[model samples]
Target chain A: MIRKHGIKLTSVAILIAVLVAWEVLPTALDVPRFIIPTLSDSLAELQRMWANEGLLGHILSTALYTVLGFLIGSLLGAVMGYLLGMSKFWEKVLSPYILALQIAPKVAFAPLFIMWFGYNSMPKLLVTVLIVFFPVLVNVLQAMRTVDRDLVNLARAYNLTRLGIFWKVEMPSTVPNLMAGLRIASTLAVIGVTVGELVGGNTGLGYLISYGGGQANAAMVFNAIILLTVIGFLLYVVLERIEERVLHYLPKAHQ
Target chain B: MALEFRNVSKSFATQGDGELLAVDDVSFRVEEGEFVSVVGPSGCGKSTILSMTAGLYQPTSGEVLVSNVPVTGPNSHVGFMLQKDLLLPWRNIIANIEFGLEARGVPKADRRARAMKELDHCQLSGFENHFPYQLSGGMRQRAALARTLSIDPEIILLDEPFSALDAQTKLLLQNSFAKTIKDAGKTTLLITHDLSEAVLMSDRILVLSERPGQVIAEIKVDLPHRDQPIRRRVLPEVGEYAAQLFKHLKLEEKAA
Candidate 1:
């Protein structure tokens, strides 16, 4: 029991140590608050925003855009991956173009998306979708292609219809791969949304960071960054739980 | 004939290789309600025969027939159990057993009933809700057998079904499998590398040569009261059959 709790205990201890150092070091060293705010000051700033600055609204907006982008991107990626994975002809025909799109830096598209969709949430959503798309596509394709041939042959031997084979064999076999991709995509979705805010978003945690940097309010920037990190961590944990539940039957090696 | 492979030949195209013949003019007939085991060296096209019989592979030449009908596609009357149990990991044992029945459009309740019956028959009554991973190797193989049997296929193809089990489990499962297949009156074509397995379970054993496999010998197993395979293994004739198959396989191995 102690060993099982060891990691969490150590993490908490380290976190407290860091917070203490963050709070004490700046004032002890006579460092300016604007340059490096104390932990207390950042927390206070977070509270103030929560109470009066509509920070909750900003968090909700970012979450919405992130989830929407993640869902759309994952859906499109999975569909495209299924097509490419199942058909060698399509893979051969379209792989080069897909490669080019994947390799191109995503940040470069933010400005272009802004130009097309304007300064509204549309540009941010599009940016997030584009950023989250590739990992899901690549993972899904790899998973589908490498599905156990024996299982597929078993289905064929049973004289399952083409659709039946796909539903009963192909889909279930790809769940692990899809779950892995979705986990990755969820994290990337957060980053994608942040990047969008950094580039052109008007009211999100990303915008707060950008605004705080301009005003040299280190406390505000730290607060926004902390919240963003927490959001990403929570998203990852939830996705992992879903993965665990869905793939409960997977052997230990797979888990 | 419940199943017949008439001068069947199969070749696969390999990377940068012109062609690799796997089965060369192999011919065999499996009578209704008979259990025939094909023993050979690895890569001797033992599985190729089963696949062709299942209609998953079309022969380069000749034909595979089931109940006097040419197998143009996957034969509905055939149930193939692979070396691996190949149970759907996401499904429980009962669900896996019902996979073929579901594909055949059996009603949900009917397939469930059939699956439960097979599970009980396989001595896995309580494991119906358990996943394949939760079961032991022997149990998993029995579950695979139950799944195949649940479909009520006239022809059953077993590819090294008990090869992955422990020696004790193999013997036990083999006995039970022999009894089950006999009771079902299904024509079973088993492919394996184990000579003893062939001698113990088969009414007839077909020994095949190495790659580009062809029948080297066919020996009729005439053990008394063959239904009790584990008991017959103590008899002298089973050893003789095993030795005969070993000799034929060794000859092919040396020739290769």
Candidate 2:
């Protein structure tokens, strides 16, 4: 119980310690302001960027694209995973295509996507979907395929139809696997969005990181990376909590 | 007819042995409401015989008849409970029992009532809402039996049903085995490796040779089917009969 909230405190402490070190060490070393900005210098830069420019809006803009891309990618992956799993013939035929897509470098398609959808949210969204779909699809399909054979045979001896077996047997057994897949997919979805933004996105965290690098504002690039990483962490933790609550009645191992 | 195996032969291709014969030219008749058992060594293909009877696997050279009609595939009127209870964890007891009805496309309302009736019959009325994981192993087997009986199958094929249980539990279960079949007016064919279980529960026991399984003998059990297993075990003649069956099975085991 004590450890439940310990993670949050530990994260805050680590951030404070890094900032304190960043603040004190630069001044002590007499490093130039541009070369190694102090924590105070970074904060002042943030404040000026906020006041003189639409920097905060850009951050929010990037977040929106990330969230949208992730949602679309994750939902489609889950649906297709279940559909393919439901049919053996379809699984045999379509699973190879899905596997090939998963293994084929997602970035290689980025240039092709730019040509097809152009440098906008569409290309970024497509890239995000490509990255996010594989984890959920693979996990969900495996979960469905690997139901206890005895249970299925039992159902059959009772003369259960395919639909009946699937609803009462296959789906429930796969839920733990589904949750695991979702957890992984949730994190990957963010990566997908940012990658899409990096290659062709105009209004996401990916674009900001690239824009910062192009302008030689290392501080802004660091800030974008920090914010994105925090968002990714929060998304993962939140989804995991939801999975736990939803699967509370499920049998758990003595961890 | 309670159960009939008409010159049944089951053969499967082996890696090096080429078309390994499991049960060859086997014919047996079980009377209506009779409790019959087939006892053999581990590789005697007792399960294959049971599976053929249940219509899970087909006999290569013959037919299995329950009440005269040949069984080609799974029949709704035939209940099968394997060694494992095979209960779906997601479903509660009532729903698990109703799985048969769900497969048959029985109406939801009727299945609910039928499930309740079965639960009451199995003395698991209060546990209808409990999951398989929550129930005791004995209770789970009881529920599994209820699930089988719910479909009102005339012939129940039990393949190594008590093999997974502990010795005390197996003993307890073996005691109830005969009474339950008699009380339900259901003909039962139990396949087991335990000689005592076959003698204790069966009205007639089929003894088979190992590997390329063949019916060596059919021994009649003269012990009366009683309500309690402990009392059944204490019967003076029961032990002698079990010992006789044990010697036959053991001799075959040594030869194999």
Which candidate comes out best when scored by lDDT?
A: 1
Which window of ten consecutive residues has the lowest lDDT sum in model 2 chain B? B224-233
* lDDT (Cα, tens digit) per residue for candidate 2, span B103-174: 777899999999898788777879988888778788888888888888989888898888899888887776
lDDT of 2 by residue, A1-103 (tens): 6786898899999999998999899889988766777777767767766786567776676567666766777788878888999888999998778878899
User: Which has the greatest TM-score?
Assistant: 1
lDDT of 2 at B89: 73
RMSD of every candidate to native, in Å, equals 1.9, 3.2
Where is model 2 more than 4 Å wrong at Cα?
A1-19, A22-68, A74-98, B14-17, B176-179, B251-256
Relative to the true structure, how large is the alpha-carbon lDDT of every model? 0.88, 0.80
For candidate 1, lDDT tens digit of each residue in A1-255? Answer: 787699899999999999999999999999999999999899899899899879999898888888899999999999889878889899989989999999998768988988888888887888889878898999989888898888888888888887788889998889888998999899899888888998896889988889889989899999988888888888889989888888989778732
* Clash pairs (backbone) in predicted model 1: none
The runs of at least 3 residues in candidate 1 whose Cα sits more than 4 Å from the true structure, single-residue gaps closed, are A252-255, B251-256
The per-candidate count of clashes, in order, stands at 0, 2
